[model samples]
Target: MESALLLAPKLVSNPSREFRSNVRQFQSSFCGKSIAIVEFTRTDAYTNHKSISKITSLFSLGKKKVKTIKRETVIPDPDYRIPIVLLGFAGGLVYGDNLLAAAPVGLLGLLLLFQTTRVKFVFDDEALEVKVGEELDESGENVFVGGKNRWKYSSFVNWELWWPNFPILVYFKETQTKPEGQIHFFPVIFNGKQLYDVMVERAGPSKTSGPN
Candidate 1:
């Protein structure tokens, strides 16, 4: 379904010499198709995960020895959805150099696209790894690619979690100098129940009074 929708644009006749325009059209089609795929895959993954979890629980009912099972939760970074939609909408507005409509749309779309770059959060026993532009493996493990921002359990201090609209502010005591201290702001959007608990457990106690 998504492939057909994406390729459907190729059938539209373009009698213009502007190669950039054609590229933009192609990209817009790609983004639109991606949104469709993300929505479908998200729903499918959730359903499959639930079914698999039930089966696993039933199979593991009568285990002999006691063991500690590490929990893993995969949360899709949904920041890209809005930007991709905006860009696709902008591409729709572009009708052969119609700057009046296209210019603002294109600029706004560019900004949104910048914000929409893929990001995923992987939480495990040792560290909280942030994987950008990568997904999970077949066994539901984070595919450790090149770009990964990992925060070890002992990396930050002053674990302050704020209200409804706030980011997790943690101080990197390791980076603190005699004059000033370094603070890192992690957006709360990537946070979940398990992830939060793991972070707190790893971080232990807050050393500093505040982000100061």
Candidate 2:
């Protein structure tokens, strides 16, 4: 009876069988967890790499694609040769004894006589260029000076035209320090309507107010 009771407890316990079942469950769960972790890591890495490649490609394309296209026009400056020459001659007459004073007056006369009477307007998609100079080209036409200034299209705000009284005035947006914006005045000689139309088309339409 004592031997049977001891044997009964051993059969009920079954330690080896329970231990084997726990080991199998642990191995199956660990394998599944490791596979899921590997898949998540690989997916994350691929997505990050693809996004980086696309951004790099966009920057490369922007750098290569930028280009500039330009056109040139010559507008004659208002003829003031008569007044300039007269003023210079008068100055020389009044200061005849002073070579220093007379020299400047004489030089002024000569300079004005030879100065280019036209302003060369160069237009690019980006900016407007103004060049003032008197150099002849191979074809015997007056060319502009080497140096030039540009007014960007982005700075422009609005323009006004007065038809027959036609001096088109263009205004730019003001900054904090400058209460009044910069103003550009251009006198139209050829065809006011046509020139205004072209300017509006190229400059991308703005508030055009008044023949006033």
Which candidate's lDDT is highest?
1
Best-fitting candidate, scored by TM-score: 1
Q: What TM value does model 1 have?
A: 0.35
State the lDDT of candidate 1 residue by residue for 63-82, as single tens digits: 36669886555453444444
Model 2 regions lying over 4 Å from their true place = 1-117, 133-148, 164-180, 189-194, 210-212
Clashes of each: 0, 0
Could you estimate the TM-score for every candidate?
A: 0.35, 0.34
Give the Cα error of residue 58 in candidate 1, in Å. 38
Candidate 1, backbone clash total:
0
All models: lDDT? 0.46, 0.44
